[model samples]
Target: MSIAPKPNPALAELAVLEGEWVIELSNAKFLPGSNSRAQGRVSAEWLDNSALVMRQWQWRRQGDLDHRA
Candidate 1:
């Protein structure tokens, strides 16, 4: 697959994460303990001058674990 190019400076600067991010998970904890922990990734790309698209993926683990996206 062809990879997407990088965004411009103006678009990059404008793409701040100013809003609140609400994440939901299934039987996962934000921290590691007796409960299983989930690792996630956040990626951003410019859709236009005024907006951007963000994506997130979640995976479960106790320690160093492979992530699937």
Candidate 2:
């Protein structure tokens, strides 16, 4: 008899966000004096040192992700 290996929950959660993600917030304020389209970019990658790092950047300028105004 053969038994299948159990899936790793941490890996599963990490899988969902393993790729680059672009998100936009419509008419939302992010900072104290920011009231415009909030765009964000998320990057997830595993380093060669066996460490997983997630980086994100948010902007409210043009040419960024549209917040659907």
Candidate 3:
């Protein structure tokens, strides 16, 4: 038989971030040639109450799609 350990107190505190977020970046002068604007969505959740996992989907102003898993 196996038992799961309790989550760390500090880690559990991070549960407050468990939700969806809308992100926007405007006039970011990182690129040399063109101004950059982006919109994205982030989803955060706790996995098995042990690990915090975040997934993100983003679209650049030029219609480029980015995803992180």
Top candidate when judged by lDDT against the true structure = 3
- Candidates 1 and 2 compared: the better one by TM-score is 2
Evaluated with TM-score, which candidate comes out highest?
3
* lDDT tens per residue, model 3, 1-69: 978767877796788888898877776775333566676777888877788888555544446657454
Which ranking of candidates, highest TM-score first? 3, 2, 1
Assess the local accuracy of residue 40 in candidate 2 as a C-alpha lDDT between 0 and 100: 66
> TM-score, each model?
0.34, 0.43, 0.59
Give RMSD to native, each candidate: 8.8, 8.5, 3.3
- lDDT of model 2, residue 21: 78
- Stretches of candidate 3 off by over 4 Å are 1-5, 26-35, 62-69
Q: After superposition, how far is residue 51 of candidate 1 from its true place, in Å?
A: 2.7
Taken over the whole model, the C-alpha lDDT of each candidate is: 0.54, 0.57, 0.71
Error of 2 at 23 (Å): 1.0
Task: Using lDDT, rank the candidates from best to worst.
Answer: 3, 2, 1
Q: Which residue pairs does candidate 3 place in steric collision?
A: none
Worst ten in a row by lDDT for model 2: 60-69
